[model samples]
Target: MKALLVIASLVASIMMTYAASPSLEKLQEGEKIKVRYTSQGCFHSSNYLMDFSPNKVSIYEFLDKKNKNPTKIGELTLSDGDTAGLDKLFAFYGNGKEKIGCTTVDNISITVIDKDGNTKATYHYNDGSGQAHRLEGVITLGEIVHRLRP
Candidate 1:
């Protein structure tokens, strides 16, 4: 079956696979900011990068490694209660870096930014690649990354 999704978003000047491009200076609760990422599952299913906003999240799956534009999966509007979770998630974040031990597990990299384009956190879910970098801590983020399931 043919599938399609439409999302209205302001693409940032920086083109990234998993990073939000929003100007956030005076960002208030319920305001429009975004968190973006690409989730890799353990089962090797179809994966995609998503843009998460206060009200909704949109998804696009890559067709191939060389593909630039992706196919839209769909959009999910968040409920009022979702903000609380997002709030907690952002709470664990800060501006800095960390060196985490390598672990062989499925993970996704997520980057969050403040209104001024200041990066609050950059979470890299590595499979023990021996590379070192860090930003924030989020355990339950698996739920958000679950959207990549297909």
Candidate 2:
């Protein structure tokens, strides 16, 4: 009886661990990641878009809230190093589902999608806090955008 109980506990532990971590390998070719940042105020607002793909990364500055017809401000080809960094970051993120409680004017959203357009993961956070702050300084999409940008 005790032996059976031990086996069951071990199985449960393994399942819990797996459920808490996201697998970077799941990101395949053509995967896309989009990040949107918006600053809202009484007088004016600003918007920015960051896109990451298997081979390219792009950043655009929008002139309106609708994000219509924007100018490409920066772009770069994805390097192996960038992929490695993302893998490390996602590994550190684990389940990647946590509410980042912050208070600031900047609103940020990140979305990851597969080649088939299936959503993989999404993160949303706001507050004047640094972009990487919510990630516990592991890494930030903002940093990736900056690197991709000129």
Candidate 3:
């Protein structure tokens, strides 16, 4: 009986934690979504950005590791299917301020902005083991964006 009770309590606690976690906000029409990836190292560092807005998608490469002054590398007009796919993927990230930091050389961040230019939600996560594993979704998003690079 004690074991059963402990299991039940654990389950309840986990449920509560999930309930409190921020979920990805739904993307509205004309809303903009941006994903940024930065990689730093002792000798080399780089930053990449992907922007999704309405029916368009743009990718850029930053000249420096600090994510400043990006030069447009590619731009594509999203087809109906591409837009739908992007919306589905972004929705996977539930809305809220999700900031998970770890000691690592790679970082991924996502920002959603309303049509009025108001920030909706921002998520930043570093790539590492342990607690950093919780933000694997951000890493996955980064990989997707990388594949989109032209």
- TM-score per candidate: 0.44, 0.53, 0.51
- Per-residue C-alpha lDDT of model 2 across residues 1-150, encoded as one tens digit per residue: 999999999999877755543333345678887768776655646678877777567878797756799888888775666656655555544444452443436676668788899886676655443334345435445565556443
The parts of candidate 2 lying over 4 Å away from their true place are: 1-26, 39-46, 80-105, 131-139, 144-150
Give candidates' CA RMSD values in order: 14.3, 6.1, 8.9
Q: Candidate 3 on 44-148: residue-level lDDT in tens?
A: 566888787776668898877565899987777755655555444443433343533534466757777889998866766554322322443333434444556
Assess each prediction's global lDDT (C-alpha) against the native. Answer: 0.47, 0.63, 0.60
Tens digits of lDDT, candidate 1, 1-150: 123222223233233423432322224444444443343444443445666655676777677887478777777766555545554444333212342444433344565655566666565543333231132332233454454452
Better of 1 and 3 by TM-score: 3
Provide the lDDT at 147 for model 3.
Answer: 58
Off by over 4 Å in 1: 1-31, 39-47, 95-99, 102-141, 145-150
Q: Residue 87 deviation, candidate 2, in Å?
A: 6.2
Candidate 1 has an lDDT of 0.47
lDDT leader? 2
Q: What are the clashing pairs of model 3? A: 23-94, 23-95, 24-94, 24-95, 25-95
In model 3, which range of ten residues has the least summed lDDT? 129-138
